[model samples]
Target: KLVVAVQGTRKQHVDTVGPKVDRQKKSPVCSYNEWDPLDEVIVGRPDNACVPSLTPEVKAISSPQQWEFFRKFGGQFFPQEHLKKAVSQIEEMCNVLRHEGVTVRRPDIVDWSKAYETPDFKSKGMYAAMPRDILIVIGEEIIEAPMAWRSRFFEYRAYRSLMKEYFQAGAKWTTAPKPLMSDELYDQNYPVESVEHRYKLSSEGRYVTTEFEPCFDAADFMRCGKDIFAQQSQVTNLFGIEWMARHLGPDYKIHLLQFKDPNAMHIDGTFNVVGPGLVIVNPARPCLQSEMFKKAGWKLVEAPKPMVPDDHPLWMTSKWLSMNVLMLDEQRVMVCKHETPTIKMFESLGIKAIPVDIRFANSIGGGFHCWTTDVRRRGVLESYF
Candidate 1:
C-alpha cells in the first residue's frame, strides 16, 4: 500500500497509483504557430494603462508629429475618457471571441501608474494592454519575453497568475533572461529629426538599440510551425534573435527578415503570417525577402492603405495597425470595424472578417493581434516553409 501525507496530517494508504498519463493530452497550452484552429487565448487589459516616459528607445520608434503627446502625457494615465471607451471596446471584443467558440482569459488589472527602480534604471509602468508584446506561446511552453523597454520590465507581473495556473496544469512556462535595461542598452544620440536620415540608417542595418545585452519584444517574432521569422528592429536586436534561435534548438528554424521601414519595431504590423503559406505584407514597408516567400509558393498579399483619419491621435504607432489583424483560425480573422479596405481584402482571400471597433485601444499602441496572445490552438507541428 502507498501512503501520502495530507496537509501535514495523518496519511492514508491506498492501492498503487497509476503511471502518469501523456502530458501533451493534459496540457492546457499547445500552440505551435499562428492560424491554427482556435482553442484558448489571453486578452490584455487597459484599466490603468500609463504612458511611458519619452526615453531614447521610445523616441526611435515614434514619429516626430506624435512627440508632443508623449511629452505632455508621459508618466500619466492615458486620457480617462478615451480609456473608458477603450475598455468598453475591448470588453466587446472579448464577448465576440467567446461567442466564436473560443475560450478567452484575461490578465490581472494593476495600477500601471506605480513607479519602481532597479540598480540599472528607474521608471514607471506601462499598461498590460498588449499581451503579444510580452507573452508568446510556442508548442507546450509559454515564454515571457525579456522586454526591451524600461517601462515594460515589470509587465510580466500582470500575467503571473495565469502563468502559474497554466504551469500547475502541466504546461511549461519559461521566462527568458531579464535584461538590465541600463543606459548602455540604448543609443542615446540616435538621430530622429530627419525621416530620410533615419531611413538611410535603417537600410544600413543600424537601429537605436545597441548590443550591450540581448533585448527583444515578443511581438518582433512571428511563428510559423517549424519555421519562425524574426526581424532586427528598434526594440529587437540581432543578439536577441540569436538567443531565440539557439533556445528553440534543432527542431525549428529561424529566419532573419528585413524591411524598408525606417522605424521598425514589431513585425506583425509589417509582415503578418496569416496561414500555412499566406502572408500579409505591408504596402508601405515592403519586405526585402519577398522573392524567398514567392519561390516557396507562398502567396504574398499587400495590404491596402489604412483609412484612419489624420486628425485621430495615433501617438505611438503608425496607421498600419489596420494590417495588424488577429487570426482566430485560418478561416476567420478579427479586424477593425472601421477599416473597410482591410475587411474587403480578407473577403477577397476567402477569409471571414469578424469586425470589432477598438479605435481607442489602437490609440494606446496595438491592434487586435497585439492585444491578445493565443494560449492553446488545435494543431500539430509541421513544416510550413
Candidate 2:
C-alpha cells in the first residue's frame, strides 16, 4: 500500500510540470550604462520628417534665425531631397552598426504630416528620427517620455512594435503619464527673442514649459549605473524630474544638474557621459555643477569647435552636435567623419573612432548618440559616481 501511494504522488508532481513552460526566463531589455558592450539597439528613422510649429516652446530652443524656416514649413514635410539624403545616410549608419556585430533595430517609417486634434490642442506629427529623445532604458524597464512638443506627442507610435516585442520577451515596459498639453502647460510670454534675456531666464531657473504638468524628453537624463543625471531644459520641467525621481524609486539616485545653456533641450549634446567616469562637456554650455564632477574624479573633456560650416542648415540643433557621439563600448566610439579633432581626441584616450558621414542627417537634428537608443548592453548595475 505504501509503495502504490508514493508512486501516485510522484506521477502527480510530474504532471504538474507542464510541457509548455520553460524554467529559464531571460529578459531582452537590459542596460545599465552608456559604455558597456552593446548587444542590441534601436536606431531612429528620418522618413517624412516634419518641422514643428513655431510655438513658444519651439521658439525657446531654436534661434531667431531658424524661426522663419519653422514658420514657413510648420506642419509640413521637410525638403524631400534633403530627407532622401538623410535616409540614405542613416541606412549606412545601420549597416555600420550591423557590421560591428550589434543588432540594429529601426522604428517604423511614420508619416509626420498627419494632423491630429487633442482636447487641448491640434497639431501635426513629428518623425521618429530621435529615439533617444523618446525612450530611455533603466535596468530592465524601458520608459517612454511624455514629449513636451505637441508635434512629437505621437512619436511613440513608431516604436510601439519594438516595445511590445520586448515586453513579450520578458522586459519591463512603462510609459509616463501623458500631459493634457493645455494652454496652461506653456508660458506664452516666456522670453525667447533675445539670447541675453534667455540667458537671464535660464539662470533664474525658468523655462518655457510651466510646472502645470509633468513633461520631459528622455534625452534629458544621462545614465551612469545607480547615479543618473538630469537637466531641466525647455522640454523638461521640475514636475517631470520629480515624477521621474519617484518613478525610479530608491534603486537609483536622480541628480539634478544645471547648465548655462539658453536653449538646452537634451543632455547628450550638452553634457555627455561617455564612459564610467568620463564625460565630454560642451564648452558653449557650461554646467554649473562641474565642480561636483571634478570632485568626483570624473574626467571632463571639452569638445572642440565644430567643423560644420556657417552655411550648413542646422534647423533644430547647434553645431555642438559634433560632440554627440555613440560609444559601442568603453573602447570604441562612433564619431562624425569630418570632425578630425574629435576623432584625434578619442584616439588619444585609447578609443577607436568609427567615422561616418552624416552631415545631411545632422541637418535634421542629433548625432550618433541621439539617433540610437541602446536596448541591451552586456553589463550589470554598478555604482560609478
Cα lDDT, model 2, residue 91: 95
| Tens-digit lDDT track of model 1 for 223-307 | 9999999999998988888888898899999999999999999999999999999999998999999999999999999999999
Q: How far is 121's C-alpha from truth in model 1 (Å)?
A: 1.2
Model 2 residue-pair collision total: 0
Q: Provide the overall lDDT of each model, using Cα atoms, as 2-decimal numbers.
A: 0.92, 0.91
lDDT tens per residue, model 2, 60-114 = 9999899899999999988989999999999999999999989999999888898
Off by over 4 Å in 2: 1-23
* Backbone clash total, candidate 1: 0
Q: What overall lDDT, based on C-alpha atoms, would model 2 receive against the true structure?
A: 0.91
Model 1, runs deviating above 4 Å: 1-24
| lDDT, candidate 1, at 124 | 95
